[model samples]
Target: MIHCARTDKGMVRTNNEDAFYLPEGEDKPLLFIVADGMGGHKSGEIASRMAVEEISSHINHSFLVRGSGNETMQIIKEAFYNANIKIYRTSLQREECSGMGTTATMALFKDGRVYIGHVGDSRAYILRDGCIRQLTRDHSLVWQLLEEGRLTLEEVRCHPMKNVITRALGVDENVDVDLVEHEYKKGDIFLLCSDGLTNMLEDKEIRDIILGAESVGAAADKLIEAANSCGGFDNITVEIILVD
Candidate 1:
């Protein structure tokens, strides 16, 4: 497996609230994550960082034992649950961090399959045979409206409440995480990113950029550059994993 990741504060944001995790050593389990935080002041930054740290720690400690597919999915769920509780508790204990929350999207590769755990508007996608498909749904009001047929895809692009996410880690005492499993093939590319990238570029635009790049690292750099060129309004983050 080959992977690359990038994050930027964007052209407008004074501070970046996005956080991501990419495994360093080949000995480590294959895990990647992207988080976008929300709140006042620097709390959003703290929330996102905490989410990545807590989730990575949980998975690193618990993922060593091999298990069935269902068991692995359960492990991923537990990692999210544990991180939620930690972030939520921190929000309650620190007045400055009150109401702080973050979107968490993670991909864990195991036994030729990728397990995804998601919350908020961040997304996970798979590219195979020169085609791209979204693997997770956005947990936001506009997405809900779009699903209900009350809003069209074109409307979602400029909706006033497009940034209003309905579900996130640390906002409430409990968080509902979405889980998905996909079998990957050689040469397949998996992407996990924050809305900063998606909000600035359309799906087709993203697909083209990745397909056009010469390497995973270059693709990540291009994605961030493209988002910034499109008037980056928020922090941008991208993680790309190529199965070999």
Candidate 2:
């Protein structure tokens, strides 16, 4: 079974632009999501909420939950795509929300396996055997530079456009999701988080907190607090999962 907990704090922002949900059914580890929305006047909040709700709804409505996809990757991809379309259509009708978009990441667990689908910069990571591995790529310009050797990681961090995301929900009608699978083992831990936390905290700092926290819920809380202790420049969201 999977035990999990998550949170979203708008921090200094006037409105919350992050959202997440932990759906309970069989009570096993499954379907955890985190979204960081972009826009103003509550549009970011709506976009993020829409992303979390739609993805959760899509997965809940699908029959794949029990059918098994151990070696398949299509289900994870479809869920993100469906959520993006719905959010796109929503912005079209609500002129007040035009141009709003969000970065999203989802984690799914079944039979000791973990599947992740992602877009934008939000990420999924696993900590096992005292090592942590990032499982998704950041679809941002700074990230592009880092990958292509155009910009250094340190430079990207302090860049004026550090938060300028290159891809997101409702920004384009079409989206590509990063899909990854990890074979779950006892004592493994997984985390899904928005860039808010990452933007303020270093990767090693995060790993240290996760390793030191007493439980998943504690880890989530401590991570949020740690980010705020720094600058808390934006909203922060995190999901921490433990498998047994």
Instruction: Encode model 1's per-residue lDDT on 1-244: one tens digit a residue.
Output: 9899999999999999999999967877799999999999799999999999998888887885578888888888898898899989999999999999999999999888888999999999999999999999999999999999999999999998999999999988888999999999999999999999999999999999999999999999999999999999999999999998
lDDT of each structure? 0.94, 0.81
Candidate 1 stretches with Cα past 4 Å from truth are none
Which candidate wins on lDDT? Answer: 1
TM-score of every model? 0.98, 0.93
Q: Which stretches of model 2 miss by more than 4 angstroms?
A: 27-29, 65-72
Clashing pairs in 1: none
TM-score of 2: 0.93
Clashing pairs for predicted structure model 2, backbone only? 2-29
Candidate 2 per-residue lDDT, tens place, 54-155, comes to 888777666364566643367667777877888888788889888889999888877667778888988888898888888898888889889999899889
N/CA/C clash count, model 2: 1
